[model samples]
Target: MTKEIEIEAKNIVTKDEFVHLCSSFQLKKQDFHVQHNHYFDTAHFDLKEKQSALRIREKQHKFVLTLKQPHEVGKLETHQSIDKQTMDHTLATGIIPNGDVANQLRELGVTTNTFTLLGTLTTSRAEIDYKGGTLVFDESSYLSIVDYELEYEGEEEEKVETTFGALLKEFNIPKRDTDNKIARFFKAKAEQS
Candidate 1:
């Protein structure tokens, strides 16, 4: 298990803006890869109510369970690696494995067993190093909805904001409020229901 503080700035973009950014950044088709995020929550969204989220991310045949919670500077992320069998069992039984992530949820008053598979969101993503941060371009699809986003993840909040802002200005992309993938997925799920 590993823990980290995730500080990032992000904005939603239009399809045309997404393409334009790709062109400006010289991101080729091969630069992109696909990842699947399987979100989980209790029936009443207990975790969501606490401003926390849990997910098992599958990338390149590997799975990592992560729990994100509110923190002073940014979201605190706890990650634990799991195998395919574990992933399947959790999805089928709504039981999380014994690990730091589960422990963190328990600390947040969220029982591990209460979680059920909410849904999955798949994204075609590309990343590049820019201004001492990782700049990400994502086109994600979930529940018949597709969206584009640009994110800058870095250690320093001020740098992340300034760098991300400059990039948007450079490309003439408008700055719009953007929810993280899990939140967006939850919103889409609610709309569908």
Candidate 2:
């Protein structure tokens, strides 16, 4: 089991802005990689109601199960690495293997018995070091949705926000309230239903 406070500031960026940032920041093609995120929730979206998200992310031949819950500065994330066999089983059966992540969800009133795969979002992402933090750019796709995002990850809460704000201002990117990828995916699913 792994625990951490994820402090990050992010904004929804336009395609042009994404291109501009990639060029201005000199982001290399080599740094870009693809990550597939499989999101899960109950029939009634119990976890989303609690402002939480559960996902199994596959990248670079590794799998990690993560549970993210709301926190003051950012989200608190609990991650557990699982083998491909367990991941395949969970994806096929909607039954999470018994473990800390399962127990954590149970404590939150979201049992694995009711969980199902809601959707999968794939992101072409790249990261660059900047201002004592990491800046991330993502082009994500799922269910007729294609969007770009800029995120700043930093150790300190206040500094992250400040630096991110400056970057936003410098680029003249308007501030728009952005939802987490899972939430956006869920909303799209709900709209189609």
Candidate 3:
């Protein structure tokens, strides 16, 4: 089982500055990479509130699934994620796993794409970008990524998730715009409305 320590933040950040911050983060010793992800989603299961979700990720080489039985305290009561990184046969589409990985993933529907990287010398915090739906370039002792983003394409609803940069004050980091490109994107959209 994979284990991680998560730290929740108040607001989001930008993408550009996050990349710059990666040079000083602690994930340098770990692996780092840049990726472009395209996701295929089904219907929206909105329950008017933050309801529990059962997520499954299908990749070119593997699959993963996680179920949040209940949505409370920003956490999941029960979660399971499985991946199949190596396959012995040619897959017509999506990743192929020999054993339980394939069986488990097939039982659920999950797919994801993101560019992940290790921190170089950045602070141990991450920010989210609401418009672009990218995790952006985030710096954390445990997690650092570049060119990373999550987008959900559904029939009637779409969701984009990303991280950004900001200056922290007294632990609660607020939304701080550090990239002009990102700022312009949001500003232009706002003005159009």
Candidate 4:
């Protein structure tokens, strides 16, 4: 399993800032996720893209698993996750198994019409729990976005998450980087001007 250090910022930022910041920093885009993404006719999974990733989920001796995409990995660059978060760092955990996740998909307009399809599609995934930090870069989706989850571990299991627009500060290019969607978007935006 591969590993990554999730970066965190001090406060929330806007989409406009994300676009501007990326170009300002001269960050390049990379096709990092394509390697593991399993493309399906209608749905797929992507977490397996990193040759099995090692996640340092918040608190509780870090568990091991081949990073798995809990849902269909689409070309559109979209994803969803649940993190169990709390104020303390040592007790953090990420995965939360519950039925509410399906409802979340339906609320997001990602549901299907057939039961077979519904069973085939995945709406929720294992959670990521990190204390004093959260995941910033997602190698999925086509938007300039980042996510940070706070996890609290206990019998009750509480959680809180924060997602924001992202600004690619740098890209290693062909080696390790985003697919360059934000760059293309900004380029088109500049050309239209």
- Name the top lDDT candidate: 1
Best by TM-score: 1
Tens-digit lDDT track of model 3 for 1-193:
3322212222333455444444444335243432212111123322112232333334344444333323222323232344342211112232333444333334444332211111122223233343343233333221123222212211111121122222333223455433322223233434655
The alpha-carbon lDDT assigned to residue 45 of candidate 3 equals: 26
**TM value for model 2:** 0.95
- lDDT on C-alpha atoms for all candidate structures: 0.91, 0.90, 0.30, 0.26
RMSD per model, one decimal: 0.9, 1.2, 12.9, 16.4
Candidate 2: pairs in clash: none
lDDT of 3: 0.30
Write candidate 2's Cα lDDT for 1-193 as tens digits.
9989999999999999999999998888887999999998887878889999999999998999999998887998989999999888889888887777888888877865657898799999999889899999999999998999999999999999999999999999998899889988988888988
User: What TM-score does candidate 4 reach?
Assistant: 0.20
Give per-residue lDDT, candidate 2, residue 174. 93
lDDT of 4 at 15: 40
Clash pairs of candidate 1?
Answer: none
lDDT of 1 by residue, 1-193 (tens): 8999999999999999999889989999999999999999998889999998899999999999999999999899999999999999998988889989878888899874657799899999999998888999999999999999999999988888898899889888888988899999888887878
